[model samples]
Structures are given as C-alpha cells and as structure tokens.
Target chain A: MNVTEQRLPIIELGSLDELWFQVAGTRCNLTCSHCFISCSPHNDSFGFLSFAEVERRLLEAVEWGVKEFYFTGGEPFLNPELVAILERTLDFGPATVLTNGTVLKPEWLDRLRAAEQGSLYSLEFRVSIDGPTPELNDPIRGPRTFERALHGVELLVQFGFLPIITMARVWDESQDAEILGRFRAVLHLHGYDRPRLKVLPRLLLGAEAKRTCGYSASDRVTAEMLVGYDTTQLVCQHSRVITDRGIAVCPILIDSPDAILGHTLHDATRGFAVTHGACATCYQYGAICTNPSSRSPDAHVRTIDRT
Target chain B: MRLAFFGGIYNNHLALATAIADARSRGVDAMWCLGDLGAFGPHPDRTCELIRENNISVVQGNYDHSIGHGLNDCHCGYTDPRDNHFAQLSYDYTLAHTSDDHRAWMRSLPAQQRLEINGLRLLLCHGSPRRTNEFLWESTTNTQFLARLCDDFECDVILGTHTGLHWTRSSDTGSGVFFRPPSPIHQVKLNDGGLKKTPDPFAFINVGVLGRPENDGTTNVWYTLLRTGNDVRGGRSPLPWEVEFVPLAYDHEQLAREMQDERLPDEFIETILTGWWTTCLEVLPSKERTRGRW
Candidate 1:
C-alpha cells in the first residue's frame, strides 16, 4: 500500500439537496480490509457527531429544500447519542441509517419503532452483512461478525421488519442470483421472506487498501469518461456528509482534508469536481445514496461494460 | 378543525399516555403519532397494539421500518456509546418497562400516511415523507417548510411529529401550514418567530415545554386545547368551557437527568429540566438515577 502523504483535495459539498449525518464518524469496532474510511474503534480521526450538531445541520438542510436525511458510521451505534439524534432528525424528512447490525439489540429496534409511532415522519435501517454467511463474510468483516450480524437480523425479522441487508460485492457477477437466493433462504429460516438485499462494489481505500490492494492506476476516473454520464447519481452531486470536523463531500471519502468544508452548511454547498479516483467508480456504477424512497439503483444507471 | 400529533412514546408510555390522557382530557378531537411501538421499550408489541386498538393514524417511524425490514439503529436518533439509543439506560429502561407483543406488533406500521381533517390535507408522516430520519422543525425556513409540504406531497399540513416539541407555521403559499408538537427538545412553539438567535419564550403547549419562562429549565408537559372552533381561550383565555388546553405534568428532575445523560449542553439541559423535568421526561430520568451514568 502506498503510504505517501497526498494533499487531500478540498472538494466542495455540491448543491446539497440533502445531508448525510455521520453519527459515529470514522469510528467502527472492526477495521475492514476494504473500508473506504478505514474506520475502527481506535481510529479517532473522526469522532461521533453530537446530537446538537446533527440537529443544527438538519435545520440548515431544511432551508436548502432537503427532502431526506441519512446516517452512516464505523458503526452508528458506537455513538452514544445516536437514537436521540435520529429522533431529533426525523422531523425534517425521512431518515435512513446504516450500521453493521452486530451491535443492534432488540430493545434498540423497539425504541426506533416507538419514535416512528408518534411522528409524521419515517425511518429506515440498512444492515451491513458483507457476505451471505460467515464463511464468505467473516473473512472480510472479522471473526464472528457474521454470526452476530445475522442474529441482529433475526431480531429485526422477529420484530416484523424486513431490513435491507447490504453486502459489498465480493464474488463475480455470475454469483449475484446464487448469493441472493442463498441469502433469501437464510432469511426465511430466520423468518424474513421479502427481504431487501443490496450489493455494493468495493472502493479501493482505507483498511481494505492495506489489507489486500489499493486501486491501480487503471482504476482512476478521468473527466472525459464522465461526459454525458449521470453526475447526480453520485452521492457527491446532491448530498454532503457531516462529520465531527465539518461537512465533507461524501460518506466514502472522509480522510481527505479537502473533503472537509468549514463549519456551516452554506459554506459546504459549493461545486465539487469529481476528480478523485473513486469518482471513476461512481461514474461507472452509479449513486450509492440508497434512499428507500428513491428509484432503484438499476433505474438510472447505464449498462456497465463488465467485459 | 383542531388535531393533535405526536411521536413515538416507547415505554415512555407513562409520559406519552399521560400526554394522550391530557389531550383526551382536553377534548382533543383527534390524536395521531408517527410510528415505533417498540424496539427497546419493555412493551414493544403492546405499544403497536395500543395504536391499533386506538386506531391512531401514523407513518412508519424508522424503528417501525427497521423492525419491519430487520435492520438496526433502533432507527431512533439517540446514540448509545455502547449500542445506539435503544440499548442505553434511559431508553432501555423505558423499553424494559413495556410488553413484548406490543414491540413486535409495531413492525406493521406504514412508512407514510395521508390524512384530511376538515378542509386541511395532512401528511401524517413519521419521518419526512421523502425518507425517514429526516427531521424538519419550526427552526426550518418557510421555504424549506413549504417545499417539504407542497413539492413533497399534496398535504396542506404536515403535522410532523418527533423532535417532541410542538410547533406550527404558515407557508409562503399561504396554502397550508406544517405543525410539530412538543418533542424531546421538550418545549412546543409555533411559527410566531424564532428569528432571534435564541428560542421563543411562548411555546406550542402551556404545559409540556416552554422556551424562556420555564419552571426549572426542562419542558413543562403542557397540552393544547384546540377547540372545535377557533378558541384560543383554552383556559389561558377568558372564555369558559369553550376554551380548552392540552394539560400535562412537568417532572423537572427527570428532565434534568435525561438531558444530562444525553450530554445535552449543561446550560440548556440544566435550565429546561431543572424547572420542567417534573413535567416532561420523569421522559428525562431523575438526576439521582441518571447522574454519573451520563
């Protein structure tokens, strides 16, 4: 892995129609090989966002015509004020939170359930399970993470919610149906039938970069390649993630100081050229914002030349 | 023409039930909530069943959606250094205090709802209609508020719940208004004008929470009595029974404790809960119970 110091670009947070709240910001219990942020419990490069901070951004977004809110983290649960912060945020619009599912307890689901009960807003949860079962997933996520994550999934099903289980694509394209089928059966056994599963591509950065390999020169995204491409499909086009340091361009690139905008939302809402290598993947694949209310990933994306 | 909206009560059932009881006592024509019968509260399924039993209209709050989809985050915004809000002491205490089927039953909540009260079209949403976890408050701009209300949906009023504080506002279109009742922020205030750097002194409710002239600093569990007609004289007014108000108790200590545990700025928490805890969170635990733990 290349350890050379690179001046992170100060990417502007684009005409932000939305804001992503990094509740636990760059803090996670497990340091995955392919984690874009290389988040781990010990890595305090970014800390948890205070409940007040989140509320503040949410209020600001409300002015920008933001229609929704989303949360992500090393493990959002790592932040102590997560639920309270979410409750505070839900009033602005619908909210979706991403988590590893390993730490999710039944009671936590209930509190969320309760909060949704009394409001006029909505909430959704996306659980991260990189592989179908432990064998395929534990290798990437760490020891026993799959088991605990699956258990957490069971609680969600038992509670009657069919959570969207997100997994980074680890196998070849030919394995999609097989993996999904196997996952369906597994969820059925655990009591979920119409389960929503999301498969993501790996971004070569963070712990994953060091664990295996980083993106090669061939992997870089060039400006010419984006001509006529759907730029808004990328999270950077319309969304900015708020972390402890400040608002950044997207959830996938937190380490770059350039990703950090000043203290306020108004300052963050400037144009950001997708010059980073990751910009190539976004151009190739599509936006990964994953709002349940949004069109499916297949909706606006073009057929990728996986030749 | 007057309707009431609220957010998840969890095992804060006592607090919520009290709020509802107060609303009922005040003769509120209708009461609604976002959704989340249970995730952490002791009575998950029961809370779900209660709404079903009462037929309380609601949109699926994140907890309800997460539970329905088998995801996690409690889906509530509360953070648990140990596990998000659901697993925390104050939140868990409420969940542990509720029933099982109740929590389980909450999974069936709808993600969105549309209601029509009198001539008003309302979006009874748990989160923003566009997505969950999106919080819109009175603190938001009239433009943002109008956009969320008009462009997002066909509702004339987004009786938005959550945030727990009560608020109401007229849009730029003058076509409708969006309202948020008392939230965990404790107090309730409408769109009068939060323009000043600080919050407004007069709030949505006389009891649940008030910004400035608060008792100890916490939300005062005040309720609103929107009469069948336009009667602002609900108790605070000169009119007799024609005037009604939402009456709620204030538990200042509990408010103080919950705020402290949540690490709310000491100045704000101390003030709201010191005087209002007795009314709102009792929802806020007592200082003795939440000290050190916070």
Candidate 2:
C-alpha cells in the first residue's frame, strides 16, 4: 500500500489499569546523556504536579477502575510533595515510583514505610541505575551518579523495601547475562542480597535519539501488524500518563505533541493511533513501562488454544 | 449451595489431598481446581491424579497450557532473570515428570468455566477470565476493574487463582460500574433506559493456591469455601454469597523432602520448609512482597 493508503493501527484503552503522573515533569537533578525526555536541572518545560493535582487524579482514577498508580519524572523525588503524593496514593491503590535514586531522604522513606505498612497497597521504588559500575554508568548518567544511586538502593534496603533496580541497556544484548551477573554480585556486596533488577530497552527519543539513531521513516506500527496480536502487550492499551500539560498516551512519548490525548482522563480514553517510531519500540518490546507482576504471562504463548 | 475452589495445586499433592479432605468435611456440593497442576513441587502426576480421582472441574492455567503443548516455559509472567531461571527449572522438571495421559487431560481442560448457582452467575478460571496468566493481585485490582470484568464476561462473580495470593474485591458500592454493552444495539437500549440501575454488585476472588505457602511465613496453604444460601449473613444481608478463605495445614515438610529428592531447586524447598518465597519473588506486588519474610 502507498503512504496515503496505509492505515495506522488504532488501539483502544483496554482498561485504565495504570495511571501515571509526570510528577517532576521535565526536570531532574542529573542530566543523563541517554535521558529520553532530556530532563536536567535546567529543564522546566514541564513543571511539578502539586499534591492537589495528584489527589484529584487519584480520585478520578477510581472512576476509571485504574488498577495501579505510577509516579515518574525528570526525577520524581524532585517534586516537593512527592512523598505526600505517594502517601495519599496508597489509599487508592498500589503505587510505584520511578526515580533517579539520588535524592532520597531517610525521613521521607520513614514516612513512606509507615504509610505502606498502614495501607493494604504496596509502595514500589524503581531506582534507576544505568549500570553496575561507575565506569560504565557514570559517563552516561553523570559523575558520581552510580555511587549515589547505589547508596539510594542501600537506603531503600535499609528501610525494608526491595527496590527494583532499573537499568537502561547501554551495552550490546549479548552482554546481558554477564552484566546481570556482575550487577547481582555488586548488589549482594552492598547488603542487597536479594536485589530485584529490571533491564530496560533504550527508547530512541529525546537525548537518546541524539546519542543513538532516531527512528527511520519506515518505523511505524501498521494495522496489518496487529492481526491476532495481543494488543494488551502494548502500554497504551492499559496505561496513560498524567502530565502538567495534560494526559499523554504513554510515559515515553510525553515530549511528542500528538502524544497528549486530552486535558481530562475521560477525554483521553479515545482510541490512540500507533503512528510513532517510539510506539514501534513499545510494540517490539511489550510492557516495557509496566512492572513485571502486572504483565500477562501468556502474552507470548500464542501456541496454546485458549478456548 | 456450597463450593470449594482450589488454586494452582503446583504438584503439591499432599496439600491437595489435605485440602480436598478438609473441603469435603465442610460439606461442599462441588469441588473445582483452577489449574497449574504442576510446578515448584514434586511428582506432577500425583497432583493430576488426585484431581482426576476426586473428579474436580479444572480450568487451564498457563503452566498447564505450557506443559500440555510442550511449550518452552511455564509462562508464569516473571520478568526477572533469576525468577525465570527458577521457573524454567521447575517447568522442565514438571514437564519431564508429568505423564502423557495427564498432559492430554490438561490440554482438554477449559480456559474458563461459567456456572449458575442459586441465581448467581459464576466464572472460574486459572487467572482473570480474559487471560489465563493474568495476575489479579488484591492490592492492584480495583473494584471498578472487577466490575468491568464481570460485565464483559456477564457474571456476578469471577473466581481466579493466578496471583497465588488470596483476596477479594467487591463492587457493591456502585463505584466504577459503567455500562459498555456487549453489542451496539444493547448500548442503545441501555441508553434508552430499558435497564436503569447499575450492574449488580459483583466480586473477584483469588481462591488461594495449594501450590505453596502464600509467602506469608506459614507452611499452610489456603483454599476458598464459597457458600450461597439462606444461611449466608443469617439471611439478613441482601448479598447471597459468602466467601470464607480456609487455611489448610498439610505435610509441607514431606513435600519439601520430596522436592529435594526430585533434585528441584533448593529455593523451592526453602519456600515449602520456611513458608517464605525465595524464588518467584519478582512477580509479587509490593504489598504482597512486604507481607512475606523474603
């Protein structure tokens, strides 16, 4: 089919299973070279979401049957009310925070530990540490970031939390086993004996697009690609990100103009056209944004007759 | 009517036997096994045999689907490398040990079962009704989502067991109960006020598994005893269903010893003996994980 005849695949919101907040917006303490949104200390294109905004969204999320809540940003902890935001969120459902892991305070963690204990929901801390060693991660994330993030992981462990250490894949795929082995050993040495590690595929957007190569003109999800496919594997099928500007289709595409769906959660429920190269990446690696526990296990097992 | 729901036997035949006996003693009218008949335990055939001998209705779980079709992995939905390593170990062992006869039987099991008990519509599946390997953790699953599942499946209750943790969410309070009719004609009719009230209060129950300890630092596994009759709430409450999570204490030490003899991972044996999950920890939500001693 010609470009004019080719139709972009449209995926409807399956269920508002995950509602994420760009709490810190496009602002971070450290500007990693491969940062997707190019978040840095100076970047304030998107500002912090106040406690009231999160509370309003939390209440609105209940109406949508939102299963879980996620907090992300240039750095979620950069938001002054982040701890309180999370504390209030636990009242609604399980809460997961994606952080650079350098700005954590014992006082904040103490309050969070108490909040989690009091509530039925779980408070998950996904600490971003690009690699196991400073030599590998420091150049990408910034100087001393690796040590700072490791100390943050140590603090989380000390606070009785099994933080999921998230790392962006900077090396080749073949090095995964070796890298993970070394990562585990490093974590064990720091008293995190049973550390949880999550390796993320690099999203070629923002700073990463400049670091690597951007998506080519041919990179797009076509309607034909979705036949008999488990669309639920895609993040947009079950999640939406609430940003200061408005609601975005997914967390990874907040910078894109078309990514913003609407100002309200209800208005954002309209079907999304998978037309971006980033969307193709989401298709290639399904559920890249969601926690492992939330992903459907039989997603790839198409051989079974699920009658 | 009283029914017993067992989740994920996972080759723990000892727990299955004890739970069956205990459920039978409770005067359950029917017994059902939500699948995963093999994993993390010894002698997959024994669990399948017990389910067959007892004549319990089975729902196909991801593990059952994998083993039946000779798939590569258990599809237990663990994303961590360590978790997958242990899962593969368990899946390989179970696949090798399960008899072809039992594997065929597993292949024949339904993905989900719909039943009507005393005017209440019930759906039983290994996981959520839509997907067999879906994890419906109590803390993560909201009432509105459960209501939507009930509406889509046209059931008053959904009994599933994929997450291994036992918990229930009820949509009786009329929150998040939007009507998305199955057909466009029904949607028009509903909009025209043919059906006025919101969908009836429905529930999603994860009938705790017999696979292993609930990662709650206890050797005892659990099953669900669902009762529907005049005796429910002493006939005072409008809701007819009553859910009772029955904790079943079995010879877990024996199961662990058997696993050791079977050369299963020490992690599996440790969970059985200590009642704290060593493997498969990555698949647990934070609340569930925090509750455990791991």
Which candidate's DockQ is highest? 2
lDDT of 1 by residue, A205-277 (tens): 7776787677666664445455565455677876888888888878887787777766776667666656666
Which 10 consecutive residues of model 2 chain B have the lowest summed lDDT?
B180-189
Candidate 2 C-alpha lDDT tens digits along A206-291: 99999988878776777887887788988999899999999999999999898899999878887888888877777777778988
RMSD of 1: 17.0
Per-prediction TM-score, please?
0.53, 0.91
Q: What's model 2's TM-score?
A: 0.91
* Chain A TM-scores, candidates in order: 0.90, 0.95
True contacts kept of each: 0.09, 0.48
**RMSD for each of the candidates:** 17.0, 4.1
Give the Cα error of residue B184 in candidate 2, in Å: 14
Q: In model 2, where do residues sit more than 4 Å from their true spots?
A: A1-6, A296-307, B171-199, B233-238
> What level of docking quality does candidate 1 show?
incorrect
Candidate number 2, chain A TM-score = 0.95
User: In model 1, what is the error at residue B257, expressed in angstroms?
Assistant: 64
CAPRI quality of model 2 = acceptable
lDDT per residue (tens digit) for residues B93-176 in model 1: 434444545445556566777755444455666645654654444322233444434433544445444444444444322212
